[model samples]
Target: MYRGTDLPSDGLIAVVKRDCPTCVLTAPVLGDFVQRTGLAVYTQDDPDFPETVPGRIDDTMLDVSHRLRIEIVPTLIRMRGGQEMDRTYGWDRAEWERVSGLTAIGPDLPMSRPGCGAKNIEPGIIEKLKIRHGETGLASRRIELGGGEDEIEAMFDRGWSDGLPLVPPTEERVLRMLSGTARDPQEVIGLCPPDLVPATVEKIAINAVMAGCKPEYLPVVLAAVEAVLDEPFAMHGVLATTMYVGPVVVVNGAVRRQIGMNAKGNALGQGNRANATIGRALQLVIRNIGGGRPQEVDRATLGNPGKYTYCFAEDEEGSSWEPLSVERGLPQGKSAVTVFAGYGLQGVVDQKSRDPESLSRSFATSLMAVQNVKLAPACDVMIVVCPEHERTFRTAGWSKQRFLTRLHELCEISGEELISGAKGIAEGGPDTLAGKMVKKFRPGGILIVRAGGGAGMFSGIIGGWAASGARGSSPVTKEVKT
Candidate 1:
């Protein structure tokens, strides 16, 4: 359903290319037909193809070929009252004569010959042609750069970068990135916060190209952005807060392997393209489309390094526990991205814990430092259980739920110790003559994801913003759409 160039209402149209052997054989005969009746000859390669023809339509740009839906060269078509009455491809002399109402169209030529593939349908050419013909429906404004301007620096000058050089989002690269998903480019995904700008599929593709994302990683980036824009995630609040936190994307299910995400050693570190680019793409979308820029709407006193990019895949293969997405209610084997308002990583090294009971106690003690040791129910936590630490629980036949429940139980403490001036530092929880017990985190405030090197005994803890649960920001998970 594309709008193409118009054709003659009443005429015999002959489409031929100089590169085709069959077209060369029938070129002279096509020229003879051009002299009789209302016959038009369209040449794809060269306008001088039929030397004897008086008028030749130069279709080197492929507008006419693509418009007429031409798949093969040397195609003869009959148009009556602006309607296609008949059409024939290749060098079939009998069929050409029948369509053109002419006898002995190519008497000296052989009976039939196959035509060459049309240039419009050549590999990777159609997308270019669609752009050239204004059929791509890409609505982003084109910023033509001056001859002296560098493409890389131009993006930085436009403030489209996150303190790093961005890949130029050219039309060719954007079109390639758009091929990753079946969704329409103009389709509006949601209104990004801070500025409340409408983010479209086309807009995301542009940012993805700038983020150096492969076409396949677009879905995970889209999912992360979708989760952020939701009401529960409170992206605007996360941006305005002085706490050190940003979107920590946890990829789960088959998409991790499909996109080659890093789930093993250095899973949270650099070196994986999917891991780095997917997170960067989400941040770039917020910056470029949503207008959430630093010192503007993104006001943070001491933002962590994860604010630039923070994304990783869970080691589903190494861990026997249910995936993090499964605990969040998404079914196993389905691809999803759960975004959490997480601060920077705090390493939890426990090399002596041999059993799940011992490990849970050690984890619970460390988890109390999410916001502050004395501040109970202040924040949430994402426990990245390394393979070695996860092995202890797996050997004891501890399910993910059982291990998490044990950690919660061990985190309970007397409310008297948490009251103001009780811990000697005076930065403690509320005190109304504290006499009861207090849990370190709110119910359902902790999440566990398996990642890191298989040999390491250390797990990472990413503390959430103090504003957790229904009021501020919650970890939101959505199924990844391919």
Candidate 2:
């Protein structure tokens, strides 16, 4: 069959038939040449074409036969200058070359032999064939380096980071980090917020490794991954918000002791490996996998330093009350992690408060004041009460539930107080279910936990706002297996 040749410099012809073994053998060889030369190639197969060859329709071959008579089962026809000149039949190793005018076929050419099928081919050649057939792989390549200073600086000048030198995530470094995870490299973890792009576990590990996380820290990273994936958490919205909300991780149970997470003085500040790296790992996962790079999807206005690394442990021993994880329905013996999308913390200093009511009032007021600013009244807040403050509540016979109840009572604010110019708090418009709840809860919706060193009278209040439409209220807790 003759088809108009628009570009004669790059074009060729291939002939074959259905159920012909020799024709089948030469088909792949011709296909390879057509791909390499960037030429047009079409096949003529018999009516009973095998089911093995893909994209082979009966109408196509029939149309070719109707246009041109093909008396032979296997034929090699070369078309040049808008005419078919060279024609050959049967399998002649030397004649096949003469008809096609191919001087030398590459040694790495992927061609099917007389008795071979596509399934029995080597992986490298199979990959080449698949690529020729238009199959695409994942875009997991590294950003090129070694550019001129101006070009390199241009990338940074675009507001890519927080003005600090970053560790380039090379493919080799990423692969090594992926070796620590048990999941398949291609398995999807969840969509990261703002962009809502799918992130595989391997990709998360790659960023984690680039963030300088040790292999042992992978589980904590994984747990944080699971925490963000929780629906209420709305990681996508959190990432996209202009608020300074960031993922704050709190380790509890045996994992804190195992990973040596800092739970005492300066726990939130830095200098501890586990505390720093675990939080950094999650940030990297968000930055790289979720594509929430700063100034892009992560639109935080004056983003807090905790965005770099904000992980700590609950001082279980120092507190007289139940640990945070246990109060959140986890068993005391089981290790767990809690993640909050929060703003910078406000320290609640209460040296004079010796009774539970006084300490609770101080914490409740701090939570309410912070809650009144940006967060919806229905949104949850984290109160990091120092161990000494917890001791006062314990000495006054306050149970964990009692403390939560007292804080809930003391934190209540009127609808009028909540309606005053809070950034994320939805105003009373038509009054939907969410709006009614926001008005009803006011400041009583705060979530409080006892943590930190026993010597300190200060507590840290982590404020949160509604993200992706509503507040992510549910705290996800997964037991860390030994």
Candidate 3:
């Protein structure tokens, strides 16, 4: 693997590209430096630059520029023993003269004209340069495509997609994604599901790149991965169950706004990159690394659209209650990701409810129907309170705990009503209790968060897996660390 070029032990290496106007203005100054001092001019774009000078090397390949870590055109470097001692960029008169040990360089020019960005710093160029220079220490296998092969079609054929076109996980992109977090790329977080594949930070970054995640979203994606892989989350069961369920990620704290996650107005729906990709990245890791596919380990009979990707941020700022992460035991002001085995979205419309009691009842009515209306404690639920709906609770001086307590109270039903064939509905609870009250959710089974737009008096309920509590997957929240 090519590392970088080694210049002479003692001399000045001046790097310039033809595209930069500053380099054009500074070309005459270069000829003077070469004649007066031990200088080697490396031209990034054109070799015939500065016709007045001889012995200038053409560095149009950018190998030397990348080797020297040049970020701007017209850069002057003083090298000693093949190591850079001093460097200066653009047309800074005094700075360039000092670096080159030459007097009055670029005297006719102004104080400085900021040089153009180096070619290696261009969007897709640096990655290629990194790969060519062999800087990335990625451990994943490299798959080179045929010259005639279509990259997009190739990924689908290889079963690497979740029914959507994915961003190619090129080495450069993966390396860029890894820059988001300070954790060692090779550091193993834990074993991923089904296949029990060891998941490393680098592997997760590869999936994050494929998921179209920006570098900043990598920490959140990593947190989501860790949360689901948690022993309590029961990710394998969630994937293997025939129930129409998948992981629904809820982000909280400062990260929501920092990553530009959608906390308002269609927060759960499409159009937000961070929301969509962070969720998708986790699934891709499960699919690619854990080998959990639809017909494979993931046996969801009729999966919801969220099986593709369902993630959103809680509207903590507009919420009347504490942030979901804080309520879940994270310290205030920190960021976290909570993963829940959720089935589908059920929205509750209560436009007329001006008070907490009325709205709470409306939410209870919809939540009670979860799994089955006649069943008792069948599944857990996640109630996403909208801004307008939360207003009703805040106006009535109801805390989040108070609202949840009332929801559990209102969800209580007679054991006789829940017993088999009580309401003419076949799906019902056992007949152990002849006349007793049964709670709709077990303790801590009801998860509530604030989301959605400001205008709508609506709230969403994500019904949890029927196998709730110690029996199945419960919500797992993990801190997002850099």
- Encode model 3's per-residue lDDT on 1-482: one tens digit a residue: 12344566678888888889999988888888877886788888789975656888887888888888899988988877766789999889989878877677667788888998988767667777888878788899999999999999999999999989989988989988887899999988878989999999999999999899999999999999999998998999999999988899999988889999998999889999999999999999999989999888788889899988899999988567998889899999899999999967898999999988989899989988888888788688899999999988998999999998999899988899888888787778788856899898998999989998889887889988989888998899999999
- Candidate 1 local lDDT, residue 189: 82
| Number of the top-ranking candidate, with TM-score as the measure | 3
TM-score of 3: 0.88
Pairs that collide, model 2: 18-46, 193-236, 194-236
Candidate 1 has its poorest 10 consecutive residues by lDDT at 1-10
Residues 1-482, candidate 2, lDDT per residue (tens digit)?
26533324324544455456776666566555655554333344353343334433342323343233344545556666666777666666666678767755534433423322222122333333333334323346546655565543654664333344444554544544554556666777677765677777667766676567766677788778878877867777777777778888888888787778888888787788888888888887777666677777777777788888788888888567787778778877788888877768898998998788888778766765663443334456778888788788778888878988877776554444345343455643232323333432334345566666658688888876554224444455665542
Q: What is the C-alpha lDDT of each candidate?
A: 0.88, 0.63, 0.88
lDDT of 1: 0.88
Error of 1 at 362 (Å): 1.6
- lDDT: worst 10-residue window of model 2: 115-124
lDDT of 1 by residue, 226-313 (tens): 9999999999899888888899999999999999999999999999999999999998998989888888888888899998899999
lDDT pick, better of 1 and 2: 1
Better of 1 and 2 by TM-score: 1
Question: TM per model?
Answer: 0.81, 0.61, 0.88
